[model samples]
Target: MTNHKVDTPSKIEWTELYNQLLDKVDVGIHVIDEHGKTILYNQKMMEIESMESDDVLDKDLLEVFKFHNNQHSTLVQSLQTGKTTKSKKQTYFNNKGQEITTVNDTFPLLQGDRIVGAVEIAKDVTQLEKVIKENVLRKQNTKFTFNRIIGQSEMFKSVIEEAKRATRTSSSVMIIGETGTGKELFAQSIHNGSSRSTKPFLTQNCAAIPDSLMEGLLFGTKKGAFTGAVDRPGLFEQADGGTLLLDEINSLDPALQTKLLRVIQEKSIRRVGDTKDKQVDVRIIATINEDPLDAIAANRLRKDLYYRLSVVSLLIPPLRDRKEDLSLLANSFIDKYNAMFQMNVKGLSEDAMQMLYQHDWPGNVRELEHTIEGTMNLLIEEELITAQSLPTKFRRRYQNSQSSIPEIDYPSLSQDEEIKPLRDKMTEVERMYIQQTLEANDHNISQTAKILGISRQSLQYRLKKYHL
Candidate 1:
């Protein structure tokens, strides 16, 4: 044809482009075929494993990657379920025998209708210094204030007023709440609002550190006390003239709790190897995830220690008792997730909001925040959170509740077109809603019928009629 030139991409061009793109990504990327043989990977994976691609390629991942063979491994779970697993913290040994700790998000890669393989994106958490620095930065950025503890309910209001009064003095504060309630938020707010706000504010989760290590971490350790132990200041010393938060204080061992009571009473502490007591001016703030009386009864917390810490107490009510605040909390979370995930989610739909209101939030505010963030991540193509669009975990929970099932929105017809009979329109709407409910429950006929509030036979008839 008149010297026409058609430009066709070479097979090598696409492979080179894909490899270049993979290498440019910052996080570790690993891909394995259906047989678990390493098919393609990037430079970052090699760096994380301390191995070259040539050595790993064509090898069975389970045999080469020590983490792959484990039952709890996300990659293995993805292969079994053909589903994506996100942000699972895992610790494993590499090929070089070096231990590695990372947060991995793995997904099953699909080609058309078949699962071709799986891919994982990994973020290293083994670097303690980096993780610590990031935590410090995050704490600094959030900088909790009194106004940030959002709730307008009278009970919450009374608690806030009492909390503000606690900030005016150096008295010890005891914050009691169930897990996932905003115990730490109140602690941080109290510390930041106090006159010693500019001073060193430190927080330690008492439940996290072992009893043997807890003593040295809360009270300084001196040289010769233990092998290779150098003289060092602990949290009480480091947080001098500021606030020290002992989170989950009920987890403290009986012996350690006695020592803690002594320190609080005398306002001093002695190093593990030292013979003399050293004076300190740190204000203690202890939080417990259980009732103080119950904890004392169970011997989990000391009665004397509880009295010292409860000089000023703040008891946060559970979410179920604060239904008046659900809408407010939901809107606040929506705003937060909008900024966090960089999306423009306007608000929750009526059914979605109703679902939230009806369900008892056992995990409290933290759980709500996580749900919002996760739902926002899944709403890539939408601006609002609807009942149908909620994550399966929440959807199933909501469906199990006694609340009415949410119906899908039916399309409106134009006046120029022939209008269907009322019965036909209703049938179409009902069928569509049933189909959505069935999909949400992964086509479990019994569960679908239960969620839809109908007999199994009726659900079966509809499913057959709809050919779904």
Candidate 2:
């Protein structure tokens, strides 16, 4: 028979190893006696409470340390129960007067089935809680991505690539796209991906604020600079060492544009009433719906500022130009609204999808999203959205176009055609013609309006009025 033996370490060596293991553990451990006096505590526990082991040992638990109502009650309940209470209780104040939140489990120490003391195990959970909160906020705030940009066409791919490339640089990027093309999204992506990601990313709509308030809003005002003037830092200062997006920058007043130019050029700003110049390290990302060159020529944008901002200009293609991405975007919005409204509406029907593809989205992605949301709100059943489920204007637009071909006019056709007044007939013809033109132009309203010898705004008004 073969003999096998296992060797064990000495008692002293084992004790040292156990102590070393407990010392390296991340959780805090402490023990209190039946008299409410601390008998043992680990280094982690002392560090967590910001107290030394020597100072805490033999100290009355309630007298030496104050706990919040929740923590105190939890500990007392555990002691009374003579059993462990595992919970996520928070102790508010630390030694430094800062709030410290922790998750703790308190267990009663048993000596022959009699509670002699209690041991508490805790972990610092402040950072973990903060991370969880931030994640929830991020999920709630932004969910759309390139897929949500809508458009499967090659034009969209080119624009996305340009946007991706612009995100890699600190150079001022100017996104030139018609209103509602999701320019803000591209700007957000750039800021989120840049080296200044951890810093503040601010957005100011140049058109949203009036000229009178523009200076104060962008460069900030000093105390008593104006009525009810409290000292407040402007967006430029607030976004210091970060990125500031100026949306619809062309809408700024000419003088404000000049001041903005200097801020962008010199990398500094002088507050409204302050003489001292404060240095700012801010990256400017401006968006404009108009052509920068045209804006400069019209004195709407300063030439120098326009040139500086256009150092890396990106043009976001209109949704109509990227028809291929329509299905992807439509489905994305369907899923989003489905979850948001808690509705069971699944998706668009093939005919509804065809109608979507055929329609010219003058308002771009924003318009599409709104349309989908509106449809979902009006949906009556769980079935797919059909042409009949579409808005009245869309139905009229589609029906008028379908009937305008002037085919063989039978009684049924005659009833469908019902010769109305000349003005009404002309209006119907005009509407159908416009729809056909927009469809032919792939929903490019600018080109369609030009071809129809009408203003783009006029076309937009008609589309909205007809719910097209």
Candidate 3:
């Protein structure tokens, strides 16, 4: 028998090793007790925060550090929920009053069922945020004229012509399209070609912000409006001489929609909690994912507001609607990433092009762009992206769609439904598609679910419902 002797360190050595290890890491590490008192912030954290070791350790974090104290704060959320909070972007001021952004992951330090403390691992992304802001500024500055739209389809051409004519006059333009059909791109192009091309161009997605903040964002807030509020310029004021694109415009609250209509008609805005109004010259361009008439019918948008905003309407066709442009758009995206990633990827292979056309493209142009960029990022050696080089979701969808042709008829779950109603025939087709998808992947539920874009539980329900 052979005996192995382990060289275990003493308690003091173990503690020293832990501190040295944490201090050597790149990311900032902060720890606090369950009561939100600081306990074990590392040296990296002190350096990032511009503080010394003794300045933070064993103090109540809220009292010592300048956190917003809102739900967006990392420590507050993790301590309240008693769960790991991760990848939440927090914009907070440093000791020098410089607003720094960080992507943080915080986990509760647990001992059995009793909660002891929590630890936060943070990465400073302030520079990355600066780059993103700069890119946005560049887009606002660049001229995305009609020539930059990258499509030659007749339907697409007609829309571009209408947009060009609309740019001749500053009638409020409303662009309607499915999500990811380049509504914002169209908005920017219209702004660039307009008489106000030299002025500032800004955008606000109505659906992304809360109603409480939406009002203040559209119309600037006064110093006395709320706690910590300052007299700042709003989107209307900022884009005074140029254009302000309100994306997902229908998502604004009904009351706010009425206010928006007033601003469009009055060409002025009153800051929140202010008694006076400020006049401004700004072109309002709104975009909706669904039809404006449908939104009005559903009462999601004000009827009067709709009429006021839709003076000049443009509809960007979906990728599936302009299937011919798929190849062109694919090439355009390839060119974009080749410059951005410095890759020599020539273009998609013939089979890959066919696969792109076969897709339904529920996510439209944005999804296609992501698919192409994602594939190019992973692609090595081969200059031409083939069907095999496609993302897992795209490849699976293409394969399942190809297998659905009647020429390769597999066993149908509803065999007797062929002579029945159209709905039953559609169900039979659905069943066959799902069954074949399952079989092709050797009955792996998770992969099949991903291919179909459904939860595993949803797939299981369908499998049982269809008896596949």
lDDT for each candidate structure: 0.79, 0.75, 0.80
Specify the highest-TM-score model's number: 3
lDDT of 1 by residue, 127-180 (tens): 532334543554465488898988987557777888998889999999888787
Cand. 1 TM to true fold: 0.59
Error of 2 at 424 (Å): 44
Worst 10-residue lDDT window for candidate 2 reads: 135-144
TM-score of each: 0.59, 0.57, 0.61
Task: Please give, for residues 361-391, the per-residue lDDT of candidate 3 as tens digits.
Answer: 8799999999998999898778999989998
Among residues 3 or more apart in sequence or in different chains, the pairs in candidate 2 whose N, CA or C atoms overlap within 3 Å are 151-325, 152-324, 152-325, 393-466
Worst 10 residues of 1 by lDDT: 127-136
Which 10 successive residues of model 3 have the least lDDT summed? 127-136
* Top of the candidates by lDDT: 3
Candidate 1: lDDT of 256?
A: 90
